[model samples]
Target: MASFDKKPTFAGLKLRLMNSWMFVAFFIGFFLFWEYSVLWFDIPLYILTPPSLIIENGAADLPRLLDYTLVTGTEVIIGYVLAVVLALPLGLAIAFSTILKRTIYPFIVCIEMVPKIAFAPLFISWLGFGLLPKVIIVFLVCFFPIVLNAILAFNSLSEELTLFSRSTGAGIWRTFFKVRLPAALPQCFVGFKYAAINATVGAAIAEFIGSDEGLGFYIQIVTGNMRPDLAFAGIFFLTLLGLCLFGLVTLAERLLIPWHISVRRN
Candidate 1:
């Protein structure tokens, strides 16, 4: 919670914004010091190229980088969409059905235990060398979070509320839609937060293994060529893409769960 000497005013907002800028200033200073160190210590340019070169190369790559960023972003979204679409029903099934809870849940965990990298080549073989494999990888990485969160959310609902609604003659569908689902949204979004971030990394990993496009592919080839500046460009774009998707998830949370109380400012 935020404390104040008195009631809120425009000055308070200004002060808050000013306080936020302090961190930005600190970051600027730290980077400046690091950049100077690269120049002063005669460091291998590749290991510690100043942000100047990073910015220049990154800007040079911006047009193409933006296009590639879109590809990765789309892969992340499609995979996450697929995960959400599949997770809810599957999770509810596992939660509500004894057989699924007993038999399916363990198998799901077993699949997650295997390193995704080990399976990337197999995914490429089966899906072929295209966007499909990366999409599948993203889906695989993101799917578990949603499933776990859904299972928890569904199970966490009040039994009394379910009983009361049933006693009041609500059907299962009605009860689930009105009570259980709305209650589960906060949990779903908590899952979404992790899923969103991991999906991007998953696509990057997939692209590193296969595919001819994407920032990951760029980084893979660039790093091998020992051009760290260009590699940094790829990384910069990766960070940009991740931030955009994370922002989307946060925005969706606001719209979908405004009553969540978690985001409400005091």
Candidate 2:
């Protein structure tokens, strides 16, 4: 067999680098305009702080911000892992069994219909003002999307594909792992992306409702103290956290499903 693996040359890499630079340029331009607009309009410092001020103060307060950041990041990561652990097996079981689909799935939908944020206070009351409650809140918020996507992925596989795998002398487990799992991976990743985005929000909500630490609590404190600039700084960091998590999930999808059409197209 002829080997086809090839590393991207510098010329090819140059295009991607230029694209990234364009994004950075646009980002810088946006902030410059924002800073100028705020300064020119004589906006109150407490009302709208310039980007420079946010960066300066944020850097000065980096240590405290980092400490709280780790707290929130921990909650999001732990909750995400737990949701995946619980959802994947449950989803598989539900997909494989009509009993689960008929009996348990309806109740699951009903539970999903209830606002997940409403349970944040209950979790705090039950678990107290600690990491546990925040993690549970994240788990509850992220779990449903994963399970639903899993079910959709499994059902979307054509019947002919399953029959073909069996005809090749593959048992149920072999067929699932080889044929069905690969087919389902794209949709599974779709769930993962959504869950990743929601995970941070869930942790933040829990912190806002009842916690002494984390970025959400930090934002609440700063806003209450009439320091909108510092609150905006917190918001900036929170946005970065969400984007980083979402990027990681996207990278994983690209790696794991490289042969999938969507991955190839991208």
Candidate 3:
């Protein structure tokens, strides 16, 4: 009879530990250790629940948590879309017009300099405890990075390229579409990646400030009820959402800019 199993080789084990699988293994190991330590230390559930308990609570609360997650996710998506729509044209204006670049950009920079959290209460008061306020807060949090990066991308092109396009009889729109836009796409994605992560935090902050819905509100309620495990479960979902969004943006960037040195190397 043929043998069904082979001994694990050192090389095979080393390769496995060096790749993405190792990340998954490390997280599993951490949670296992956390569970064992909590039990061994006789920690109170309210103070620090074990991973197992947190999982249990998550399973029990999954439906409600998912509902909240959906609400928060909607706000993040809407805000990010709005920021993109508004920031791009403004960024182009900043890049193409000397007056706008020198004048309006300073005011924009000054506005961005203010702490984003400071505006949460103002947004809530202005828009009330509704989706509008949450979306606006998320927009404010993510808008700056998109605009700044877009301007940088647009302006990074050499004057030689612009003259070359003009020499070829390419119209302004054609030059912009064919040359500058393609050149700017990679950096635009960098902004998108940053915005994706920030949008989640922004939504959470908005929810925390004034809302009965979303993961942030759920966490607040659970924490107030002294259910740290459930609160942490909500946090876990938010983290997953942010990571997923960031990953999606990264994937899109790689797909769109495969010719770019950064993408090719990766």
Give Cα-based local distance difference scores for all models: 0.84, 0.89, 0.88
lDDT of 1 at 195: 85
Instruction: Sort by lDDT, best first.
Output: 2, 3, 1
Count of clashes in candidate 2: 0
lDDT of 1 at 96: 90
Better of 2 and 3 by TM-score: 2
Writing each residue's lDDT as its tens digit, candidate 1 over 14-82 gives 998798898989999998997898889998976668888888987887888888888887888898899
lDDT of 3 at 231: 95
Candidate 1 — what's its lDDT?
Answer: 0.84
| Alpha-carbon runs more than 4 Å astray in model 3 | 1-25
Please state every model's RMSD to the true fold in angstroms: 3.6, 2.2, 6.5
Off by over 4 Å in 2: 1-8, 17-25
**Candidate 2 lDDT score at position 148:** 88
RMSD of 2: 2.2
Sliding window of 10 residues with minimal summed lDDT for model 1: 1-10
